[model samples]
Target: MPRPEALVRRAAAAALEETGARGAITVLLADDAAVKRLNGRHRAKAKPTNVLSFPAEAPGYLGDVAVALGVVRREARGAGRRTADHLAHLVAHGALHLAGYDHLAAGEARRMERAEARIMRRLGRPNPWRGAT
Candidate 1:
């Protein structure tokens, strides 16, 4: 597998291609505390999450994707997945969000999951929701 940073860039590019979206996305690898602060400030949630996406307000700009290193590592270990693989999944998820995909509803979530699976597969990564119920 490629390095974590490479995987992130690959995943983001794949997601953009999968969604036929234009522009570029900025990826930020941050610690848990920083992510927690961002989550609290922007999302009104005072906890660290795996990933967060801030879509660009202007046209021709994709958006920003932030990943919490500590949280991601912990979650990947708990799930028995490789760190790079998990990071790729998170990057893809955030990129999809930038492409205007949402999982707020069941139907929307299913669609998003399917899209993510396809994108990950194209990147030579495993299906993130393979065993999901």
Candidate 2:
């Protein structure tokens, strides 16, 4: 199996292809405290989220994506998926955000979901959104 960074890079390449993003993107697998601080500072959520996206202000360039590793592990266990699979999905979701897709609107949500499903299918994994039951 590949290292975490390798997995992330492969996932990033897949995400870029899936989203048609034209530039580089960063991925950070962070610990709980680190992600919690980011969650609080960036989103004002006061708690860590599984993933966060900081899109670039530039054209054709997406910015950094951070995933809370502990949160992802817990979520993956709860969802009955491997940790790597969950991590890949979160990265894909962040990449979609970088591609300027939003879930705040119904049409946008559907579009994003389709993009996510396509990416997940390519990854040979089940759709995380579909497992919402």
Candidate 3:
């Protein structure tokens, strides 16, 4: 398997290709409460999820990708996958969204899922949406 950090960064890069982002992205691993605060403050979701992205105003910088450690562990357990793999995928997905990959529609959803699958395959992780277990 790939090293955890490398996999996460690579996934982020893979996601950025479609996001049109031109700047360095900072990836931070935070706890659930921290993620919840960010989610509530930024997204008004009130609950902590797996990952969140912050878009920077500066040119050539995509801002930051934050993954909640607690949620990641919980998600990994639910998916029966390694925590690193799950974290890496969420990190990439968050970065992609920050870069502007939206899955609010069917076509866009398929494209995003395809991008995620390709990146995860390249990183030696299973496609989370495959439903094949």
Candidate 4:
């Protein structure tokens, strides 16, 4: 398998292509503590999440995405998914968010899910929404 950074970049690139988002994005693979700190500082959440997206305003830059290794591994184990696959899914999900996708409403969620599924398919990953690993 590819290194974590390589996998993340590949997934993010695929998501950007799928969303037609232009500009550059930075993907960070971090530990739980670092992610938790970011989550608290930015979102007022005290816990670590699998992934977080930070959109940027500067030209030619979409945003930054941070993924928590611990959270992703736990989630993958619990969901019976490969850690790499889950990581890819979360990375794509974050990239989509950077591209203005959200799941705050049913319609928005469906659209995002479809886009994510398509991106995953293009990456040769399974449909994460259906729990297909």
Give lDDT per model, in order: 0.92, 0.85, 0.82, 0.93
lDDT of 1: 0.92
Write model 1 residue lDDT over 1-133, tens digit each, in one string.
Answer: 3457778889999999999999989999999999999999999999999999999988789899999999989998998898888899999999999999999999999999999999889998889899866
Write one digit per residue (lDDT tens) for candidate 4, span 1-133.
2578878888999999998889999999999999999999999999999999999999999999999999999999999899998999999999999999999999999999999899889989888999443
Q: What lDDT tens digits, residue by residue, belong to model 2 across residues 16-116?
A: 89867799888988998899999999888889899899988876668999999999999999888888888888888888898788899899988988888
TM-score of each predicted structure versus truth: 0.95, 0.91, 0.87, 0.95
The C-alpha local distance difference test score for the whole of candidate 3 amounts to 0.82
The per-prediction CA RMSD against the true structure, in angstroms, equals: 1.4, 1.8, 2.6, 1.8
Candidate 3: regions farther than 4 A off: 1-4, 17-21
TM-score of 4: 0.95
Misplaced by over 4 Å in model 4 are 131-133
Model 2 clash pairs?
Answer: none
For candidate 4, what is the lDDT?
0.93
Q: In model 2, which runs have C-alpha deviations exceeding 4 angstroms?
A: 58-60
Question: In lDDT terms, how accurate is model 2?
Answer: 0.85
